[model samples]
Target: MEVAEQRSKVVEAYIQAFEDRNAEAVMALYADEATVEDPYGTEPIKGRDAIYAFYQKAMDLNARLSLDGPVRVAGDIAAFPFTVRVTVDGKRQQLEVIDTFRFDRQGKIIEMRAFWGPLNSQEI
Candidate 1:
């Protein structure tokens, strides 16, 4: 399969796992030494264990994720624009984000960076 196509599949699996709230499944798509820098500026979570913990916490919040647009793939990279809906303290909120992933030769995500900010979130 083409690299772009493989990367697209990886991104698809990622979205599916995240929406399913299966942190283990999500972590399976990442490389052993993968790094995730969610929301862009915060400290990056490195390695599978840390990444797993990060996803665990996020999934525990019961957030629902949906694709906002098509997944863009170039070479070994994929960029997914998505929306996350969550209820925090009984207040429903929606966050628009673009997450970019760099995949390894084996199709595992090596790096993930989520782009979003306070302005990207709104009450829903």
Candidate 2:
């Protein structure tokens, strides 16, 4: 699927922010009232402050993501699949993750949701 030209830029910003571990940069990609559903088991986290906390927790994992393929935009939303390689509790793990992003008319992400599962069946 083809990502909207404008939204593609915003997605790039998100990936760059993640790679940099710059919370502020990550927040910039979202609107003030943006909602995120990372680790989807929990309720959707709303607003920039909550989103900041989510990213902060992720940063604590010392995580880094390698995205696959271009962003797939469908209407006002887009999705990109990624694999995160991180070391938590002295063990390295690969996580297969899918990130879905929603954008407002102005192109700022109004909502960003992420879900993931362990690449290996071994329980952590």
Candidate 3:
């Protein structure tokens, strides 16, 4: 597949998998040695297994995530802006985040980095 097509597919997979809370589906889009640095963390999560564990924990926490629009891809990389809703301590909140994904030659995502914005900021 062309790099652009691959990028779109991978980005879609991520959005769909997370919205469905299906960790396995998300992992399928990753390379064997993929790494993820999601928000709320300093160290990156390595490998599909680790990513699966991370998603599982998020699913268990009842996270509700949604994308704002189509992901923008450049070369083998893409950036997806998203809004995630979660309930914590009996309060509902929304988190604004931007996720950047880098794909390997095989079109499998090799690295994903996520940045989060301030909580309940008027800008959001």
Please, what is the TM-score per model?
Answer: 0.95, 0.87, 0.87
Q: Write the per-residue lDDT of candidate 2 for residues 1-124, one digit (tens) a residue.
A: 3348777777788888989999899988788888887776769888777789889888878888888888888899988988777887788877778888888876788877787755432323
Question: TM-score winner among the candidates?
Answer: 1
lDDT at 15, model 3: 78
| Residues 4-123 of candidate 3: C-alpha lDDT, one tens digit per residue | 777887888777888888888988888999889876377999877788899899888888778888788997789888887888777777778888899898788898898884653222
RMSD, every candidate, angstroms: 1.0, 2.9, 2.6
Model 1 score (lDDT): 0.89
Per-residue accuracy of model 1 over 31-64 as CA lDDT, tens digit each: 9989999978999989988888888988999888
| Candidate 2: segments with Cα more than 4 A from true spot | 1-3, 118-124
Clashing pairs in 2: none
Cα lDDT, all candidates:
0.89, 0.80, 0.82
Per the 3 Å backbone cut-off, how many clashing residue pairs does candidate 3 have? 0
Strongest candidate by lDDT: 1
